[model samples]
Target chain A: MDPVGLSGYLTVGAVLFVCGVICMATKRNAVGVLMGVELVLNGANINFVAFSRHTALGLDGQIASLFVIVLAAAEAAVALAIVLNFYNNHLTIDVDRAVELKG
Target chain B: MSVPELLNHVLHTDLPRSVQIFAPELVLCVTIIALLLVRMLKWHHKFPTSWVALFGTLAAFVGVFAQFMYMKTGGELPQMRELFEFWGLTQAGVGTAGEYFTGLLVHDPFAVFFRLGLVLFLVLVQALTILTGIPDQEDGQDFYTLMIGATIGMMLACGANNLLMLFMAVEMMSVPSYAMVGFLKGRRLSSEAALKYVVYGAGIAGVMVYGVSLLAGVLGTLSIPELGSRFELLMGDQPFSLTNPTAVATALGIMLVVVGLAFKLSLVPFHFWCPDAFEGASAEVGGFLSVASKAAAFALLVRFALAFQGSGEAIQTLCLIFGISLGVVSCLSMTLGNLAAYTQTNLKRLLAYSTIAHAGYMVMAISALMVLLSGSADPVDSAACVEGLMYYIAVYLFMNLTAFAVVAFVRNETYREDIEAYNGLSAGGPMTKLLCFCLLIAFVSLVGLPPMGGFFGKFAIFASALKAGSVHWFLWVVLAIGGLNTVFSLFYYLKVLRAVFILPSADESRTVEIPGFNGAYVALITLPILALGMSWVMGDLTATAHDVAAYLFH
Candidate 1:
């Protein structure tokens, strides 16, 4: 298999997407869901570089992906902080238990 | 030829300009590394580590300012400066001469402006961290390290010119933020918020990756400059044989990728996590997410939109659709955000809706940019919109901070964020009353009313839209709706205002005690809310925006 082609990236992306779905489905810990984010980003990244190689996305695809990474970090930070605060009032970070928010 | 060899060749041509363009952020990188090394040393709780981060941010601010001045000084030859950043870049990078990393990244007014924005936000967050002091439960050392680490990622995001850089920058920033969010792991809601963010984030990332793969498969290269060269060709051609399969699959992929980015911006349909996350989080955390994260995401949106603009390709057309979709989503978002805000009494949730509405405002700007992308190149392309977004976010930071500070103050006494909890707040608490008034200014600004920084920012954006959207009445009507949404927004923004001031005090006889210097920290954020609105200090910001627009749209 030639290492630098479309199928390669497509496969990587598919694997990542599936993995993230599974992670989102299975994760009970708040931080574990965040791990899914890391995996998900890695999946997109593979696609970005793949495109950088095979298509006219050129640098912009890569650039857009890069911005995505930065934002994910900012989002994670605030999200984690909020989660911590939530636990300060509650005792568990179980997704199922967050029902107190349902007013 | 191989990728590296080809990239090297491109780099050779870009070197001279690259050095100048990369200077501002490069300066921050050096300072950040130095701070990291400094933090590794153990001092008797007297190392003044927070001051170190503050100083670095300020220096980065000064460096970015200098870089902006340098570009404005040398690159003002309107026609030439407008042509390409490679020509106008003049920032003196540190340690060695700076150079472009091919056209993947470039130094120019726009990058300088975003870098400046990052510096300000970094300083803002650092100040909050410093004033709050170390949480009794956590180690202060690693916290600051992660904070600086995340700031570096943001700085890099502003400079990113290609896809690889974008991804790396996002992860670089996100990893640290995730840690920060879980800083209070003992608390369940905070942990839950972190979990929701991660799951949602990962899911969105998957969609984005699939989309990027499709884009790469179809386009052949991820370099935006190269993509621009082939924009018409890629978008204009049918890649998937003599069948409709090509457009269907590729467009779907592109939409998927947008979902990833859209998730970050909390664009309506993908915004399920926002209210809960805001409610579950700390005020500081909420404030940072509401402003900094949005600013960084807008930068990505501008870059992506610009990359695919025109071409009449399905993807380019997809971007146009996304723009309209984003606008439609934003209008609903603002209404939902503001109107829902009226029903809820929890300050954080109200602010959450408020944050959603602002995201809608930004997306609306992006939507307008799409129309501009679809229309002609006259009155310029989407640059005006980008510039408007930058200014809008600048206002958002200060206004949001003021709002959050007030909530933090109230939280200390009552530990409550409910609307009725604010009853008679002004009865005996003088500072709380003053803080409430400042928050009123912030709310007015958020709704885009006059004399505040928010109004000026919105006015500039709307005026630009009127020009770009003029050719298409439908586009104009959509933009008009965006304007109307802001008015409708006022009703909800004021509801919170009423809660803080007009409603009876939650504690009539007892007042919350001020926590030393922390009171001052809350007051300090108000300076920018008033300054940028009054002194036109953001003139440089506004001027620099012209270049940011040109960088992307041109």
Candidate 2:
């Protein structure tokens, strides 16, 4: 069998990205939404790594993915802290419950 | 290059120059650390963190001011160059403009201009917080830390030259703001706002990065300037269409990235987070997000869009489409924001919607800019489009700041931010009257009436859009809609003013009494809006903006 090519890796990344967007759209749990965001970021990361290996992107793609990883982790930490704050106040983590400041 | 050779060049050459060019941000960094260290060492009792933050921001402002002067003077001033030499920062290192930090970012007149505005804004915000006392002594360190960190991120955003740097800058600017929106820890609304802000922010950021990956992979590069050149090569002279997979992917990437920026600017469709976050956050934080973040995002937007500008039929077609789409978004943002703002009872929510509308107006300038650049229009006219944007942002900083400052002070005295809370403000004491007058000027300017800065800003942008209509007839329609929106906006602003000046006080026994300091602060910032209306001041600012805008084209 032929080795899995760039298109195969791209197909996987696209699926992950589509799934993540769907997850974000459907999920009402704040943490679930955050996890969706993570999935999307990791999907992008996979694309970056695959492109670095397969294309003329050279080291830029790999370096960008690393930065994205660090940023995603930091974002998750801040998001979780914010979620904790919400839970403390409302006694739940459902985003639908955050309707206090609606128009 | 061997490791040692690369290290030698970087250590001796790149380090000094990059550090010098990056001095203002470095100063801000040290300030952030000092703010934390003061609390860590338990010195908060004797020394106030607000003072520390103010002085640090002032220092950075001076640094940016000097850098601006240096760039404008072309590093020819003997005294200024000598001053830099005194600090061991060479003329070649500080004032000279080009890519810095291995082309990850740039040091140019445009970036310096935005940095100057942002740092000065940081100083002003610090002073306002000192007066308003939003964060008590215990939370001062953490508050200023987040605020300065965000400012630094915004500064970087103005200078981002690479796709990676662009993403990093946006994230850096956003993360701290998320924490800040929820700074009032005990408030349920504040926490809720932060929750919504983070979830939306993270989701959009993910979509944006994914777009970045696609663009980078398809183009095989991440450098912004290279993206254009690579794109031109990829397409050759072929017409750009969906049938071409490369063009399709590239267009998708660009659209997704713009969506993320649109979210930051609170344009229509992606603007759901704005009103909630502003109403949840304190008025002071609202002021920061509305003014500083908008300025930085606009700067980044211009930079990103301009990266695709070049001469070719296909490229021109793409740019024309981009410009038209931007015009559509601008139209929607303005109309939606103004219409939504009409019914808002909460002052902060009203201002948030107003922010969205103002963003729409500013984006109109950019749309004109893109269209002008796409066509073979006069370079002078293209430069004028950017000039309008720069002038608008500068005027907006003062207009919005004054408005939010009034809200903060009133909230302090009355602990209420409803329109009803401001009823009969003009009937109060002298200080309250002055505060009310300042709000009138801010609101009037926001309505783009004459004899105020917003008029000139709106005039410049509308004029540019009219000029762009010569290139494409659609911009004329955009301009007309913009003018009508300006008229539409006047009623809501007057509605608030009527409440303040015409309506009777809710309680006959109670009168709002604004402190002298807060009243003076509002008046001081409001003076600029009035002063900028004068031809002399407007001429000077326009010239400066022209100079900065010219840098991008060159």
TM-score for chain A in each prediction: 0.86, 0.95
All DockQ scores? 0.36, 0.90
Candidate 2: where are CA atoms >4 Å away?
Answer: B1-5, B76-89
Candidate 1, which CAPRI tier? acceptable
State the fnat of candidate 2 relative to the true structure.
0.88
Superposed Cα deviation of residue B293, candidate 2 (Å): 0.8
Span of 10 residues, lowest total lDDT, candidate 1 chain B: B90-99
**What's the lDDT for residue B68 in model 1?**
62
Q: Write the per-residue lDDT of candidate 2 for residues B1-554, one digit (tens) a residue.
A: 99999998889888888988898899999999999899999898998988889989988887887788778886667877765554445568766788889888988889999999999888888889999999999999999999999999999999999999999999999999999999998999999999999999999999999999999999999988788778888999899888999888988999989998998999999999999999999999999999999999998998999888888777787888889999999999999999999999999999999999999999999999889878977888988899999999999999999999999999999999999998888998999999999999999999999999999999999999999999999999999999999999998899999999999988979899999999999999999898898768888888899999988887
Residues B1-554 of candidate 1: C-alpha lDDT, one tens digit per residue: 89998777667656545555555456556666666566565442556666766777676676665556555665355554443343234434321222257555645556667777777877877777666553431355466666667767776666666655655666566556656665656666556666566556555655565565565556565554444435456445753332565556555655775676677777778887887777766777777777776777777767666666555555455555656676677677766766677677688888887888788777767777777766655646567777788788888888888888778767766777787777666554566666667777888888877778898888877776676566445556656777778877877777767766777765567765656566667668777777778776868667767776665555
What is the Å distance of residue A33 in model 2 from its true position? 0.2
The model with the greatest lDDT is 2
Could you give the fnat of all candidates in order? 0.56, 0.88
